[model samples]
Target: MGVVERTWSWLATGAHWSGPDGVWHRLGEHLFLTAVCLAISCAIALPVAVLLGHLGKGGALAVNISNAGRAVPTFAVLVLLLLSPLGTHGSWPTVIALVLFAIPPLLTNAYVGMREVDRDVVEAARGMGMTGRQLIARVELPLAFPLIVTGVRTAAVQVVATTTLAALPGGGGLGRIITAGFRLTDTAQVVAGAVLVAALALLVEGVLMLAERLFDPVRRRTGPVPG
Candidate 1:
């Protein structure tokens, strides 16, 4: 009964918005925080993953470390950061915490993807006079791109959902509503916030699918894709 009520309440969230401006403004803030955290996490993770992958050393060790990172509770990490240099009171700090939450997936995907690129392909490129950068840009990254896209897709969804944790720091998101709902015992608002989060997840997943298709080298190799 609680679950059904929650779902119905979520469905009805949109009707409670006071005006177009308020609705768009709040949603826009949510998106801004989500994008910022996502971008920061990917930027930091990709290069490190690629470098480690290219080194072809410590692959298993690196993966285990990331696994540990994923294992540690995100809320614990966030509280620690808030107490330290992160200060925990600002939106950017919340963004930072979310980025930390996002790192394991992005790092694991990029590193593992590049590592999985066929060794023969790397050797062939080397034999053909490809430089280090050329080997990466043309050969390894291309092959690994599919896996990388999968990582980004996973990260996108995870980041969007996790950004709700930003509410702990007074950052805007559906979490803001959820927090308010918790304090007020307003299950309707809680359900509404959860609904917005689910919708946002779906929207994020759709956009990333388009990105994955666009970047897929396998599709490019097969034929000219329609614009």
Candidate 2:
């Protein structure tokens, strides 16, 4: 009860958004944290997915690993990470956890996209003396771009949501608002924090949608997804 009262008092006065370091101060951190995790995921997942999809190897194993990653609830991941070398003591745990969470979509999409590319087109590309790298960069990836972008889009949304979990371990993000509200049992505070998180997720989705359009010529011809 005291916690709730205190939380509301702070919120009513806008203290939640204006505390030392404050909501505005940490907004950048939240975006930065999400972006960093996503960038790292792409760096590893793209190459691995492309190669795995092209070779048609270890796919079951890879998907299984990614699915298992999803089962390890985000909060549990954060708690376990805190117990390890990459915990409240450091930021790497959140990075590692988010990367794990981001990989499945990428791996699945890459494999599916490459497999779905017209085999005849691939043969033509090869028949024309296109090298493996050339086929992938020119023929495969472009056609695969929309689906691949879909994976990135999914990853971005997921990362933004999971980032709040990272806050529980003191890694810092908008989750701080959520956890603080929970500790205080303040409904308004909780709502305020939740509202911000939802807004951020929508913003990320919009940006990714734009990215998909800008890169996917096929999409341009077909038109945007029905909202």
Candidate 3:
């Protein structure tokens, strides 16, 4: 049979969708890992980027340093961590590696978004007796919402796709499916695993894009005026 037919047959098998080592379980693992890594990355990156951007100080240096992480391979980072004390902690190396991989875009985009908020609008808010905290909460965050969401969308999708690496260290996730297929020399299973990951990444992107449009403060504010 052709590879496509074999792949379709593999996906159609109900047996492959049940049990601990099944597609559902692995997909859940994948999503859970992605969520953990993305949340940790956001917690680490967003505050620092926003604060630096608000102060208009130290943003360039911070962004450059974060971006430098992109130069290093996440797989290599995972390997190094696995060789360290952290290796004993279940999934810590994978989580840390994924978090680092996800941070550069979040930090860079958030900093850029904050800096790009209109200076005149900021000055007007300042002139109107708005405090720094009020300005950030009301003006800056609203305006930067789209770009911030963009960063989140980027990071989430990247994390979803990269979570497959979890299987490398005997971790769970859809990567296990691919690795198992490789071990068994089952090309069909590998293709099905890849397709699942790709589908998940696209789903995440679409959901976030929808959320961005729905909750964008600037779009709501600038919406058509009542007749």
lDDT of 2 by residue, 47-139 (tens): 988887776687787668767777778888778887986665577888888888888887777777877789999999999999989998988
Question: lDDT by residue for model 3 over 14-127, one digit each (tens)?
Answer: 999999999999999899999999999999999988888899988767679756976887767778888899999988888988998899889888988999999999999999
Could you arrange the candidates by TM-score from highest to lowest?
Answer: 3, 2, 1
Question: What C-alpha lDDT values do all the predictions have?
Answer: 0.79, 0.81, 0.88
Candidate 2 yields a Cα-based lDDT of: 0.81
User: Which scores greater on TM-score, model 2 or model 3?
Assistant: 3
Candidates in order, TM-scores: namely 0.85, 0.86, 0.95
Residue 170 deviation, candidate 2, in Å?
2.3
**For candidate 3, what is the lDDT?**
0.88
* Candidate of highest lDDT: 3
